[model samples]
Target: MDLSSSTVVENTNDFRATSIPTTINGLRFYHELDEWQQDNHFIRSGYVKGTNSYKSSFNSLFYIHNETGNIYSHLLPSLVIAGSLVYYLKFQLPLYESHLQVWEWINFLQFGFAATFCLAMSSIFHCIKSHSHSVARFGNQLDYFGIIILITCSLISIMVFAYHREPKFKYGFSCLFLVLGSICTFLTLDPKFSTSVYRPIRSTMFILFGLSGVVPIVSAVNTYGLEVTKRKAGLNWLIWEGVLYISGAVLYAMRVPERFSHVEQDQASLLNNPMVGKFDIWGHSHQIFHVLVVIAAFCHWKGLVQCYHTMHQDMLA
Candidate 1:
């Protein structure tokens, strides 16, 4: 049988309609998608219709589609982070004379790996989702797992640097984040949680996990004073990181720009109207969200570098 056939087959075991592959010539509109392909109604065009073959799906990477921006926004950043990690480890990593140095190096690696993993997984997920329904579902799980890992590791890196002197706080918070990350991983593994129906729930879970960083921030302020905490913990950068993350999340949830593209009465104004479906090939909320996520990760990376310098200075003193 041909893999590119669009014929929908019913599997009696799972009771789901599966579409075989088809040679998709051009982009599809929102209304043209099958149930499995339906997502983001606000994106009314530029969809790569399901091909149900890995070869076909991967080949789409070279073409323009709604997913192109989302894929490259994170994909390119992952490469940059990976390269930075190698450079930092090779030249800047101090020879460990103490446990603090070791932990600092470890925390730095954690942050680097998490950021790269998250971005790469997101790119892969978006790249191959059109292969089939099962592939799409699996990709969604990988994406969620990557996100949780990134959130957990980012917090762990921050806590490690902030409380480098306080062994009790440092180890305590590190363990706390590990446990929390594990819990989140477990929670997201539920198949229902991965569905679009639970998108807000998934977002809330991640937001809450990220917000848990505030606990250590408050503790830092109480123990070391606000100014010292700000200097040691990179508070300003963290705040900016938080703002960027929250902004991205809100934009993704609200589906802005595209959502407003077809609003009545405002359609006459070309700028305000968003050119009616122009965002489909680019500038959609998901694409914006991906860009903001990269920025937020960069801010965290800067904070980590600052924290490393602070640790070096304190060790010298």
Candidate 2:
């Protein structure tokens, strides 16, 4: 069937009215993951498989599909955050007293690099996952790489900049996490953990990596006192960041809050459980996870901003 340049029908009746075809151009959606995973579909609908070129795959952003939430969840943020970073940099150019040192601006750019790259790569993976198995796999690796960037960059900013007084510990743990992130990225790229059986293993790796931040947290508390650390170090903010991340990780691992009455869809009904199939286009755990990821990143950003203000106050004091 020729479905290229076709408008995505959001209504259930019209969507279902179109008879399912073996293959189509990259404008339709697929209901199941395997439909496109096994085929080079550009735009697979809820129940159909369709092929698409790179242009169509790129254009997939504007169309509605199950993957729309996943794509834009990170894609839009990527653009907005990047633009804001540039604008803020320019805004600070004329302030002599408020100006950051050269190294400080470097750190800011590095931090921005981590945030922007993670979001951008996430969008790329979700947008191009339908291109082919190779493309999807590449996207997954890019996603893993993005995760490493976020974690590593966050650690650098938190430990080094936030606790500039503790030079040894700051640089020490920063490198430690960077090395660990590199290792985890390698493991995730192995493709051995892509199967269902190894899914928990991959998730556990990420949790452990994030949990390693305790070293820095304890160091800060010990040096500054609990109350001072909480205020100056933005401990509460980081705690919220941790909470958001752990919550998202739990959802991704458990796939909760996803329910479907449509028992007929093969992938969503694997368990034959009626409570899990209704969330294909929305409310799926991955989508929820993506949203939480963004919020958590912002929480981290806010905490960093707080840290910067505290640093500034200290320098002036």
Candidate 3:
């Protein structure tokens, strides 16, 4: 068999006129991928190839590959949170003597839905990323939309709970976040800003969007006093949520753990194993980010619960 002839045949796209490889393979290395498929150089191996078809993309979910961790990390959490949210609203809420107000229920449900939606979108993006470039781009846009929704709902819910007694502040913050979220959604979904080259810009935009929460928080503190705001609003849990989210975002942006893949570890060296290619299937920065996002969402949910209890008790009194 002439290898040069085979290479020319594959390049010609004449074998049934497919874009690239028509055969489903075991795994591919970094060098084997097309430009659009290439991501995370530190993950040197374990790629699923020949997934241009939607059938093939969905089938890959059952198979072990580099994205398995990423797909399930958010997928499972999304399922769990969604189920719990439904159960709480349907069964648990009835047990309370004082039912949540209509607005409160709306905010709570919106937050839960947004959190689960974000995770589910992330899972879908990772799962379909091995498909054609266009499909992957669409999935990426869906993921960004979910992030924007989650951020907007999270801030709005927090502000509403914090300013439960102040209608003006609550309504103002809600409007502000909705407008900002719309702007973010536009930027994120834009084809030009969706590329790797604009990653820093995207990250900065999200960071700044999140930081805007500080303004409302400080305003609440000034209006209600620090101790009252902290207790009533569950500020401590919100702080932990912010810390976890920021830490995860920083790690994801910097590409930690896997970024050290270039480091060598000799037998006599302090390290147990060489860092290269070790995190290809698991323990990568993206996986860490997914876990942190889930944990942060949990913290936010718990804080909302705190606020709910306080509000009910205060109303009863």
Candidate 4:
């Protein structure tokens, strides 16, 4: 064996060739969709569509980048919400009625699970999508399912608060959202439906899904009158939460900033610029969307708490 003359070559790109990093933890950069190939397929890069294998994605938690931010924004808060739920169960469960307690528990737990599950699915899907095309396809579908769960459960939480005032209006709106969510989940599970060719369709579907909440808002106004429900839910907070969500959704769908940005150009980038290239890894729409989504989740929590307090006082009276 000529150990002194032997050479070893790693199957990674030359680090000096570009600012993009070689395969290593905590320093991964994104690539364009066209850049994905056999040599670089396994590494966890961002700005590319689809998921990798579970083996590859399992290590994603330790990595830091736009993807990490997207995953952790939802992931970390889910943990906090979980801890809070544990406390609520231990300290506050006894305060509600023992008989109708079933409904209360359902309402309370569904909201937490919906929010947490949606986030967990998003992180997991983003992590494991690198597995293969089929895996990536399913991962996207699962993420869509999580979104549906979040929408369905959010409506349920509102129902819990206001259903008693107008049972007909509440149940009607609740069931409508549920059906819409289910259809969206079903449609998204199809691989073709999740593809880039269908990106605009997917985006529009979700935006419409969220906007459908407007119907219930009108129903709510008629049911409890404007003033009463406003006090319970904190109108300003809820409105701000919606503004955040709508803004984020619009950004995600439109593919802004990056769509018109350049890494080297410090100038104001124009629309549909061909420079929508590798520059998006730092401040892309998806990362921003997840951050806004988490904020909206917090807003939803505050509204729920305020509504619960108002209901609890009424119960006491």
Q: Residue 45 of candidate 4: its Cα lDDT?
A: 41
lDDT by residue for model 4 (75-156), tens: 7877888888778766765565444356777787899899889988898776766557666667778899998899788866
Residue pairs with clashing backbones, model 3: none
Summarize candidate 1's per-residue lDDT along 240-298 as a digit string, tens digits.
99999988888887778788764323212433443556576688888998999999999
- Which model, 3 or 4, shows the larger TM-score? 3
Candidate 2, position 32, lDDT: 42
lDDT: the better of candidates 2 and 4: 2
Measured on C-alpha atoms, candidate 4 has an lDDT of 0.66
Per-candidate local distance difference test: 0.79, 0.70, 0.80, 0.66
Model 4 CA RMSD to the hidden true structure, in angstroms: 8.0
Residue 81 C-alpha lDDT in model 3: 95
Task: Please estimate how well model 1 matches the true structure, expressed as its whole-model Cα lDDT.
Answer: 0.79
* Candidate 1: residue 231 lDDT (0-100): 82
Q: Model 1, stretches more than 4 Å misplaced?
A: 1-24, 92-100, 263-274
TM-score, per-candidate, Cα-based: 0.86, 0.81, 0.87, 0.78
Q: Compare the candidates by TM-score and give the number of the best one.
A: 3
> What is the lDDT for 313 in model 1?
76
Candidate 3 residue 104 Cα shift, in angstroms, is 2.4
The total of clashing pairs for model 4 equals: 7
Cα RMSD of all models vs. native, in order, equals 8.1, 6.9, 6.6, 8.0
